[model samples]
Structures are given as C-alpha cells and as structure tokens.
Target chain A: MLKIFSTQLAGIFQNIEKSSEEAVEDAARLLAQSLVSDGTVYFHGTDEMMAVAYEGVTGPNAIPSSHFYDEKTALTAMDTVIVSARFAACEKSAAIAGAAREAGTRTIFIGAAEKGTDLDSLPYDVVLDTKAVRGLIPQDDGTRTALPSAICGLYVYQALHITVSEYLEEI
Target chain B: MLKIFSTQLAGIFQNIEKSSEEAVEDAARLLAQSLVSDGTVYFHGTDEMMAVAYEGVTGPNAIPSSHFYDEKTALTAMDTVIVSARFAACEKSAAIAGAAREAGTRTIFIGAAEKGTDLDSLPYDVVLDTKAVRGLIPQDDGTRTALPSAICGLYVYQALHITVSEYLEEI
Candidate 1:
C-alpha cells in the first residue's frame, strides 16, 4: 500500500514539475519583487494547508520577509500574498485572495484545481496546481484515502522557494 | 533545478517507504490506542514541522480525537503524543516528548535522525525517520537549500493515517 502511495505521490510531484514551471517562475518573480522592495510576502492556508504557510514563515530556508497572513494585515500594491488549500474550492482562501488582489497585492493560489470547482474561475496573478484532486489509495469501502495536500503544497512551496532564491541570486 | 528537486524528493519518499514501515505501523498502533481508549492524541512539531500536527488535527481524514499538542494539556497513560521536527537535534521536541513520557503518555518521535545527533539517543515509543537530514538541492556556493522537512513530515503523517485507518478497520 505504501509502495503504491509512494508511486502515485511521485507521479503528482512529476506532474507539477512537468507543468508548473512557468507558474512557479512567475510566482518567484512576483514574490522576489516584494523581497527586494521591502514589501512583505504574506502566506495563508486553509485547514491542513497551513503547513505550507508555516513553511514559508519558519522553514530552515524560509523566504526573507515572509509572514503568516492575518486578517488584520494591511496590504499595499507592492506586497504579495499566497493562499493555499487542499482544493481550490475553499471559499475562505478564494475570498482572501480576492480581497488581497483587490488591494493591489499580487496573489498566488496553490493547490489542486478540481473539475467543476469554483476555484477555476477565481483570478489570481499565478496558480500552481498540485494536480492531486483526490486521494491516491483505494480502500475496501471503495472510497479513496490518503489525500496528501500538505505534502503536495509543501513540495510546491519548496520549488517556489528555490526559484525565488535563484532569482534573488541573479539580481 | 525543479527537476532535480523532484527527483530528490521522490528518492526521499522512497527511502521512507522502504525503511520506515515498521516504525510507521508501530506509531499507528500507538496512536490508535488513544482513539479506542477515548483518550486524546496530541501532536507537536517544531518549526515548520507544525505542518504535520496541523495535518493531523485539521485534515479531512483527521484521526478521531486528534488535537494539536498544548503545553498545558494534561495526559494519561492512555493518551499519546507525537512530536516532530526537522532534525533529531531539536531539543524542544525532545523536551516535549520527554515530559509526555514522564506523564505516562505514549510518545512517538518523527524526524530525520542525523548521524551523531542527540535525537538518536532520545527514547520514545517510536521514531519514524523521514530520511531528510539535508537539503536536496545544492547551491552555487556549494551549500544545500530546499530542506523540505514539512513535506517529508506530511508524507509520514499520511502513511501513518492510512495505516491507522487500516488498523481500525481490522478491529
């Protein structure tokens, strides 16, 4: 079971790699601008997706000037905000991104954009898909389990972190 | 760079799958005991490792009776606490597990046990190594970055979640 899970997880990671380069690079550039301009990059994640935000704020290689997004945080056009969730259907994340974008803060949305979900219609500066719309393992009850959104989100975060670091080095 | 990061991430996941099965099952059984006994299973993590605790507490398939560990939360023999960190050298995680054990709570430790680190010596009910002691990507300065402790931690959490679900189904 774990072997299968690992294989499928590898597939998800590969999918992100194969398709998310442009988005990742674009996010890095937008986020890097904030870092260079002394504007903060705030992160928010709904539910377990908070892992990704926490990674941005406290990971060993955390991006500089990153903080967890707060409801009271006042944003400016030069700032950037990232909102992550297991699925793009999360209204809270969508609302937060919507509000942030309206404030002229660059917004990046990260997670699985499932079919028929309202997440697809939401506009953001960049959207990096994890491509994990459902759990990888099949159970005896015919339901899927082991939906690892946090892992996928963290993978995206790390990729973006590395790209941002590279972008900073080039500047 | 993202390609290299994906490949290295896959290797780390494979390493955990290959080597951490027994520990994962042991951790699952220990955690399951708390669920069956009407005892709370508390989770604590240092730094970005909090992603694991958040996953356990707020995840869609969160284990019954799981909560984020609070310093003030009292424990009993029936209760279990899982502490995670990026490396075994995190004294804060060790201290939390030690105190929990002293209170007669079953304790599980999760993270990478780097060679010659104190984490290897700290005793717990189970130690699930993430096999991610260093960052996967090397930099121009010959240093490594992209240390994805949270991603590794979440993978372990998902595996344990699946195993515990299986264990409960068997019962």
Candidate 2:
C-alpha cells in the first residue's frame, strides 16, 4: 500500500513541479525583493497548512527575516506575505491575502485550486498551486484515503525556500 | 531546480516506504488498540515536526481519538503516544517518549536516526525512521539545500494514518 502511495505521491509532486515552477520563481523574486530591502517575509498558513508557515518561519533553513503572520501583524508596502491552505478558495487565507494587498504588500498563495474555483479572482500577487486536492488511495466504501495536503504544502514551501535562498546568494 | 528537488524527494519517500512499512504497521496496530479501548492517541511533534502532529490531530481525516501532546498531558498504560522530530536523537522528543514509557503507555518514535546514533537505545514500542536527515540538492559552495524534514514526517504520518484507518475499517 505504501509503495502504491509513494508512486502516486511522486506523480503529484511531478505535477506541481511541472505546473508551478514559474510561479515559484516569480514568488521567490517577490520575496527576494523584500529581503533585499530589509522588509520582513511573513507566512500565514491556514489550519493544517500552518505546517508550511512553521517551516518558512522556524525550520532549519528558515528564510531570513521571516515571521509567522498573525492578526496583529502590521504589513507595509515593502513586505511580502505568503498564504497557504489546503484549498485555494480558503476564506481565511484569502482574507489574509486581501488584507496584505490592501497594504500594498506582495502576496503569494500556495494551495490547490480546482478548475473553475475562485482562485482565479484571489488578490495574491503570485499563486503556486500544489495540485493535491484528493487522496492517493481508494477504499471499499468509495471514499479516499491518505489526504496529504500538508505534505504537499511543505514540498512547495521547500521549493520556494530554495529559490529564495538561491536569489539571496546571487545577490 | 524544483524538478531535481521533486525527484530527490521522491527517492526519500521511496526509501521511507521501503524501510519503514512494517514499523508503520506495527505503530498503527498499537494506536488502533488504544482507539478500540477508548484511550486517546496523542501526537507530540517537536518544532517543525509539529506539522505531523497537527495533521494527525485535526486534519480532514483526523484519527478517531487523537489529541496534541503537551507537557500537561496525562498518560495511562492504555493510552498511546507518538513522538516525532527531525532527528531521532532530539532531546525533547526523547524526553516525551521517556515519560510516556515511564507511565507504561505505548510509545512510537518517528524521525531519522543516522547510523551509530543513540536511536538504538530509544525506549519506544516502535520507531519509524523517515530517512530525511540531509537536504536534497547540492549548491556550488558544497553545502546542500532544500531540507524537507517536516515534509518527510508528514509523509510517514500519512502512511500511518492510512494504515490505522484500514485497521479501524476491518474491525
């Protein structure tokens, strides 16, 4: 079962890499600008997606000048914010992205937005789709098993973190 | 670069699937016993590894009886606790596992324990190694990049969750 799951997960990862590479680079550039200007990079991950926020703000290779976004966070035009959630239409994540846009901050949204979803109208400056909207395995009752939304979110977070690190190194 | 990361991460996932399948099953069975007996299953994830804890406790498919482990959590022999960290030698995770063992509660450890590390002596009912101690990509300066410890931890958590769900369905 794990072997099958691994194969399916690899496909999910490949899909994200193929589709979201450019978006990741673009988000990195936006975040790099914040780092260059001494502006903080904030991460706001909704619910279980907070795993990505914790990685960006406090992981071993955490982005320099990063913070976990909170209600009291004061954003500025120079700052950048990354909002993550299981789905692109997450109201909580969209709220943060909207608020950041109002403050003139560059915003990035990382989540899976199915076709025809409201993601098309989100206020984020960049959207990196994780493409992990379903489970990997099927069950007897027709339901799915192994919904790894947080894992997918973290994979995208790793890519963004690496791209931002490369940008900072080039500077 | 993201493609390379995706490939390397797939390898990491495969490694965990190949080597830790039995351990995951054993841990799931242990956890299932607690669920069947009306004992709460606790997840204690250290630092960034808390992503796994959150997923197990409150994600879309949360365990039947699960909670986030805290210092104030009281354990009984009937209950089960799973401790996770980036490294097998994490002092904090070891502390929780130690306390759980002292209380006679079944314990499981999930993390990477490099060869010759003290992982051999960990007092836990089961240990599932994630094998994600190092970063995936190499840089021009000889240092590695894109360490996805939390991601790997979440993968293992997903596998365990699926196995436990299977057991519950069978019962």
Candidate 3:
C-alpha cells in the first residue's frame, strides 16, 4: 500500500511540475521582486497547509508569516502574501485574499483548483495549482485516500525557491 | 530534474516504509495509547523540520504540541514529545529530547540516522528513520542535493496517522 501511494505521489508531482511550471516561475519572479524591493513576504494557510507557510518562513529566504490559527493577522500595502490551502475554497483563505487585494497587497495562492469553487473569484495576483490528486489511493472500505496537500505545496515551494534564487542572481 | 527527483523520493519512501515498519507501528501504538488515556502529544523541531511538528498537531486525531521556536514551553510527565529533525544533530533537538526524557515523557524522533552522529545517543524511545537520501541529485557544482528532510518527515507523519487511526478503531 505504501509503495503504491509513493508511486502515485511521484506521478502527481510530475504532472504538477509540467502543468504548473509557468505559474511557479511567474510567482518566483514576483516574489523575488518583492524581496529585492525590501517588501515583506507573508505566508498564510490553515491546518496542515500551514506547514507550507511555516516551512517558507524558516528557510533561507526567510519571510514573515502568520500562524495557522492566527486569523487576526493584519496585512499591509507593501506586503506580499502567499496563501496555501488544500482546497482553496474555504472562507478564511477567501477573506485573507480579499482583504489583501483591498489593502493593495499582492496575493499568491497555492492550492487545489477545485472546479466551481469560489477560489476563482478570489483576488489573487498569482495562483499555483497544488494539483491535488483526489481518490489517488483506494482503501479497504471502498473510499480513497487523497494525497496530502502539504507535500504538493512543499514541492511548489521548492520550485519557487530555486527560481527565486536564480532570479536573485540575475538581478 | 523534477521527474527524477520525484522518482528518487518514491524509492526513498518505499525503503523507509519497509525498514521502519515495525518502529512506525510501535510509535503509532504508543501514540494511540496516549491519545486514549488523554495524554497530550507534543511535536517539536527546528527550522524547516518544524513543519512536521505543526503538521502533526493540526490534522485529525489532533495532538497538542509546541512550536519549534518556542523553547520556553513547558512539558508535563503525561506528555509525549515527537521531535522531527533533518540531521538530529542540533543542540535544540538534543536538549528537548533530553529534557523530555528526564521529565518522564516519552520521546519519538523522526530524521536521518546520520552515521556516527549523536542521534544514536539521543534519549528517544523510538526513532523512525527519515532515511534522507544524500547525493540524490547532482548539481552543476558537483554537489548533490540531499532530499529535503521536511518531505521525509511529513511522510512519516502520514504513516503514523494511518496506523494510529487503525489502532484507535481497534481499541
């Protein structure tokens, strides 16, 4: 079962790498610009997705971010916020994206692009599809285990990190 | 590069699943017992690996844990501390693992078992190898990009989550 799941994940990541390459590069360009301009980059998300934000902030290009449960965090015009979500269909993510837009802050969203979801209407400047594979693994009770969004989000982050590094070097 | 990296990850995860099966299962059983007995499960780590702790606390069968940067948080005798580290060679992880052991709290570590490292001497009751694959991807500079420990740590968390859920059902 674990082997099957790992293989499925490898396939999912490859698909995402192909499909989201342009968007990921675009996001890295924007993020690199923000960092070079001395603007703070904030990462936000709920539940397990918060790990993406936490991981981003602690890495080499350290950014400022909010905690998973800290919904009261304020945004500023000079800030660039990256919001990661499993479905990108939740109220909290929408609220943050909406508020960031209103506050004249740039917003980049990374998550599953579920069809017919309100995420389409959110005011994000960039959207990197997490490409979550639903029903990826069939379980004993007839249900399927969806791939964890954190891994997908982290993969995207890795791409962004590499591109951002290259962009920084170019600048 | 991404495709090759993903394939390497799948193989690494499979190896971890096979080699660490008993230890992962053992940790799950202990964690399940703790949850059933109303004991708090605390996840801890530093830097990127901190995501593992945050991920563990936010998911279903949610546990109580401290943030990686919050070194002041106190633990109790009834608590269980799960520490995730890339190298497991840092002072903070060592300190936390040691303190938890002295406090009579069970400690479980998830990270690479670097040969000849102090990790072998840590006070963890169980150590699930993150099995970080060194030299997995060769760079232009002739250095290999070690597989990110965060991904391996998250994979272990997923395994533990599944096994714990099963154990919970049985109990």
| Best-performing candidate as measured by lDDT | 1
Instruction: Name the runs in model 3 displaced over 4 angstroms.
Output: A60-78, A133-136, B60-78, B133-137, B144-147
Per-residue lDDT, model 3, residue B17, is 82
Candidate 2 achieves a global lDDT of 0.86
Off by over 4 Å in 1: A118-120, B118-120
* Candidate 2 residue pairs that clash: none
Report the lDDT tens digits of candidate 1 across residue range B5-75: 88888889888888889999999999888889898999898889999889989987687898899889988
Residue-level lDDT of model 3, residues A1-171, one tens digit each, is: 566667777777888888888988888877876777777788887777776786677643244332332456566676678888877676788788888788787888888888776654777888888787474668789877646688777777777766676677788
User: What is the fnat score of candidate 1?
Assistant: 0.84
Task: Write candidate 1's Cα lDDT for A23-73 as tens digits.
Answer: 999999999999999999999989888988889999887889998999999
Better of 1 and 3 by DockQ: 1
DockQ of 1: 0.82
What TM-score, over all chains together, does every model reach?
A: 0.96, 0.96, 0.86
TM-score: model 3 vs. ground truth? 0.86
lDDT of each: 0.87, 0.86, 0.73
In model 1, pairs of residues that clash are none
